[model samples]
Target: MLDFFRQFISFIPPALVPLALLAIALLLVAPLGLFAFNFLAIKTLFEELRKIFQDIFKLIIPKKWDSAKTLIWLSVFSWAMSLPTRSFVQSFIAFCGWLLLIPGIHWLMHEEKKIKEFLTIEKILIAPWITGALICFFLFATPESLPGIMVISWPIVSAIIAALPKFIKSGPAYKVPDPPVRQDLIIMVLFNLLLSCWIQLCYSTQVWLAQYPSFQADDLTNSSFVVKTPSNESAVSQGFDILRQAETALKDSLQGQSWSQVERWLLNFDDRIRDLNEQIIDRLPPKAENAYWQVEGRVLPGEYNVQLFAVWKGPSSDNLGYHLAKTCQISQGVPVDRTPWQTLSPVGSASPNTQVDTATVSCEPVTKRIKGQPDMAQ
Candidate 1:
């Protein structure tokens, strides 16, 4: 009875798995949204939200409940929510520092008369800077560099721009006059243009980073074979062992060859690897089909790196009516190096929208090494 049920499930399309999971999630979460809409009546919710917004507005701008203060706070909140948590915290600290520092600087410079004007300008300029910084941070910065770059660069640039006018006016030029409002508007526009250019550079760097594939040594050391049944474990291991032998043979044959010669010999090397993979599959208890393997070789001055991929289909366990395909790859002919495995087609199905289930073990190389040791030569 169990076998019959498994057979029925094996016939289901692989694409349906994601749809089923999504359906389950919606089924679980729909009631919560409905509950908020039903038990908490829409009219009551809106009234409560309005009160909450009023309270927050009063807290941020305690003395003045004007449209300008409301707009400033709204911009701050919008910018804060767009950032990742760490960046958001740093931005908040910078914001508080800006609020305190601007007044202190004005007081020390005996420019208290212009403090209100400075506050108004700062609030107006800050919104656009925050918006531009966040846009660059998200679209340009890689996951590793996002927080540090955003935290360090953004606040410093903002402080410089805010203090620039005071610095110029304080200079001992024969009673330097306050620039016209037109000049202030021009400065703001120019600063925004400069920020836009900086963002363009960051985006260009990100594009360059995306062009090349990363190679890591750990990806090779930690590679594993995918086996759907316990009985197939030995077969998978044997296949890997055969692959290692073939890799060694290819390396020995191609050693000391120039790049041109290696390129010429690649076709022959691939044929040999394919033959060995077939032999490995033939030895397995379950009949293997749609079997294929690829060998990639790169020759350096003193050493060469080789990566291998082998994929084949075998009889599924009785529970699944369709065949099960096992696909795995290993890196050999070098001490430590790995290339990411590329899937040519969905492992077992051979064609799109097929019922066969694929079991894939993808290898990702980790490049870190111990202290005092040289990094793995990629």
Candidate 2:
């Protein structure tokens, strides 16, 4: 298991950094494009519930009070003060809203305490039940910041709405019964489904954060990163090399020319490189800690991969290590076959299929030589 975790940590996140970025990007962008789709689903469901409410009113109450007006007023009241009110004001308005909905309105109009007024014989059950269901559907959905009020408050209101009808109609001879378990169940399911979907939406949006790349630890700090950059090179050249290598690898791995593919590759590629960059620093002693790399994942124009860069400290790889790191690119350098984190081969080594086991224990960076001289490598 320890070996498993070590191996697991070695490459999956890094290998699929490009893919993961694409998956996350899709998660964010898809829902936005499909926002209207979910909205339409909610709207259709509410319309059906509203139709049911009106029909039920006609069946039970001969003198039907158009309660939809009251419902609208209640909603307006709930929203008006709900968002702006804070601390005491928030609580005060809520208390008044609760009052208007119950005894106060019933007394003002019907001249009866709400408890008794609501218990009147002619009151219907189905309409209120449906209304409660609708309210429940909408309530938990809202990602509003102070959703504390709605989260707890609306459930009570729903209970009241679902119950008032049956209570009013049932006489002492017949106690008001609970809303059918099936009806309650359906609403609960619908509410849960809505909650899941809404949460997914929020999750997608948050996933769109920009991915900044790191090259190396400062002259002294030993930060962890995946890809390292050549420190002595001009900043522009270092960035270019990282970008070029990432782009080339992506085109080769994916073997597709689509821009979408390229964009996704870059994200994952950079993440893996960052992982590699950090591992390099972890092994260094605190003093002249020089094995840090720049970390970046930039989207290329009309390309499917992001270019990544890493910088190293210490002796050059040519002198200290044998194989020179060669960037891979697909045909015409157009399509990206692999990304930054796609498992890399050891430089100056003969094996092409060496496994990139645990990142920390598997690989070590041989510092670049002081100059580009090949003789110094021996």
Best by TM-score: 2
Off by over 4 Å in 2: 1-94, 101-169, 172-184, 187-378
lDDT of 1 at 2: 100
Per-residue accuracy of model 1 over 1-378 as CA lDDT, tens digit each = 999966766777788867866887999999988997887697798899999999987555725444344444555664565465566676675455445433433332332235344445634534334433554454347746664455435644554455455435444543433578547755755665576566666565445324311111112223343213344222232234334544445445555444445555554655665565565545544412223222222222322234443321222222221211222232222222122343245657444322322121232232122122121254
Global lDDT of each candidate:
0.44, 0.44
Note the clash tally of each candidate.
2, 58
CA-only RMSD, every prediction: 30.0, 34.8
Question: What is the C-alpha lDDT profile of model 2 across 1-378, one tens digit per residue?
Answer: 999966755677687777866887999999887997899989999999999998987543434355533543664577577778798887677656654554333333343245445545565323333344445534444544534334434434555655444445435354545669447645754664566555555444334211111112212134242233475222222323443444444444555434444445445865765654455335433333233233333433432223333433333323332112323322223323444464566777634433332101011222331233223112
lDDT of 2 at 209: 15
Residue 284, candidate 2: C-alpha displacement in angstroms: 22
Candidate 2, lDDT over the whole model: 0.44
Error of 1 at 185 (Å): 5.3
Compared with the true structure, the alpha-carbon lDDT of candidate 1 equals 0.44
Off by over 4 Å in 1: 1-191, 213-249, 252-378
